[model samples]
Target: MAQATLESAAAPRESAPAPAEAKPRRSGKAATGLLTTVLALLLALFIIGPLVWLGVRAFADTWTYPHLWPDSWTTHWWQVVFGDKALGVAVQNSLFFAPLTVLVSAVICLPAAYAFARFEFPGRRFFLIGLFAANAFPKMGLFVSLAALFYALNLMNSILGILIVHVLGTIVFMTWIPSAAFAAVPRSLEEAARDAGASKLRVFFSVTLPMALPGILVAAIMSFLASFDEAQGTYLVGAPDYMTMPTQMYSLVLNYPTQVAAVFSILLAIPSVALLLAAHKHIIGGQLAEGFQIK
Candidate 1:
């Protein structure tokens, strides 16, 4: 009877369930998921909150601090922005120059980028470093120097001159993108086209250019934004005669009410927003890293 009792006790102890290990794992997973959800919500709020506030304020008739909502809403601000002749002129100039800058930059940068990608020679690294250095240099300093140079050349207050400056500002980015894009393209494709009796230009246009179009488009969009948002260079070089949306916006901020400024801000953002929406897939999917990989 003693042996029987001892065996029964030992069997019960040995058969006892393993301390519910899965419960702790389940709790840990739940905690991690909750943490991830909280972080995502915070990030979304941080980015989207300002944009929502800006939209609300743009149409609000009267919004003051500590107020959860505006007293009323109206389209008066939109009317005011559109009705103003000077604002119209500024918009027109900005529209013209932004695209012009993109075109000029592409024309100049594409060939150079292709050259850098395809055939590297002496001073190639030096040139690339110089391009990067120029991009990294202070815009204010560059604008000041450019202003002086433009003034000396009698190029100030002209659209062409401003276009040139914008091109210079964005060319490095444009060039680098296409260079990386071209590098990512298989050389075998170009060689095959050439073997199939296609000229160098034909091969590039038919094979390489198409392959790199997404990257090029992304570069162009970036260049357009850079040129469009440029204030210091535009003000310094094209000011007093050539006024763009950015300069106009600055002036409005200095002289006009908040509603007017808000309207202008929304108007200024429209094109950029539209472009992003239209080509978002390409912009997001573009292999920027591959473009920089030379070998």
Candidate 2:
């Protein structure tokens, strides 16, 4: 009788219906998931909507007010943007200056980054803070203040002047990003290589650089984009003769037909988009965040 009673009680406990709270818990989770998915889709729509509209306008011959779609579509605006000689010069200037600026920044800033990462030096903290301050200053105001110096040095309208301006803006990116990258590298690996009969230089080149490459690559991409897109300083220092694609947009917006401006806008965006896509892997792999961590 006792054994039978125990079994009967255990069976009742095992076969009891789930707690009344269980259904509501499950329903709540499902509701939360549905809300999250809806929010994600809305955010995506907000970002992509403008780009979709821009694409529409780029090929549209006539997209008047109140029209959801273009009345006519043609590729003629593309041809117009390509055939313009002045615009071609601006495009050339952008292409030529951007890479060259990256090179100059890499040469000057990489070693400084290495020093910042590896050594404890006087004023190091102050210098790092200074880099932030340089970037923090109001960009247009900074450029305006420097214009007087450019005039004094006859740097106005000169390639060297424009190059210097671009390099100035990129210094913080080149220094800060690579410094964080180098700091994150394992000193143990470098030391082990040194113990295995590798020279310090060899250890650095073979071990440190490879490990920190993603962060350095991210920095380079940022520097390249900064120099490529800089308009305020470039316009202030090198206007009229040295107008890059961004600066040229000002003229286009003012004087050119709307479609012409749209086509040029697309062309201007292409290189930046292509580069960001190329670096997308490194960026998404957390190197960008790693480099910006200030550690």
Can you give the TM-score per candidate against the true fold?
0.88, 0.90
Candidate 2 deviant stretches above 4 angstroms:
1-22
Per-residue lDDT of 206-283 in model 2, one digit per residue for the tens?
999998888788888898899989998998888898999999998899999878888888888898899889989988
Model 2 pairs in collision: none
Model 1 C-alpha lDDT per residue in residues 130-152, reported as the tens digit of each score: 88888788989888778778878
What count of clashes does model 2 give? Answer: 0
lDDT of each: 0.83, 0.87
C-alpha positional error of residue 285 in candidate 2 after TM-score superposition, expressed in Å: 2.3
Q: What is the model-wide C-alpha lDDT for candidate 1? A: 0.83
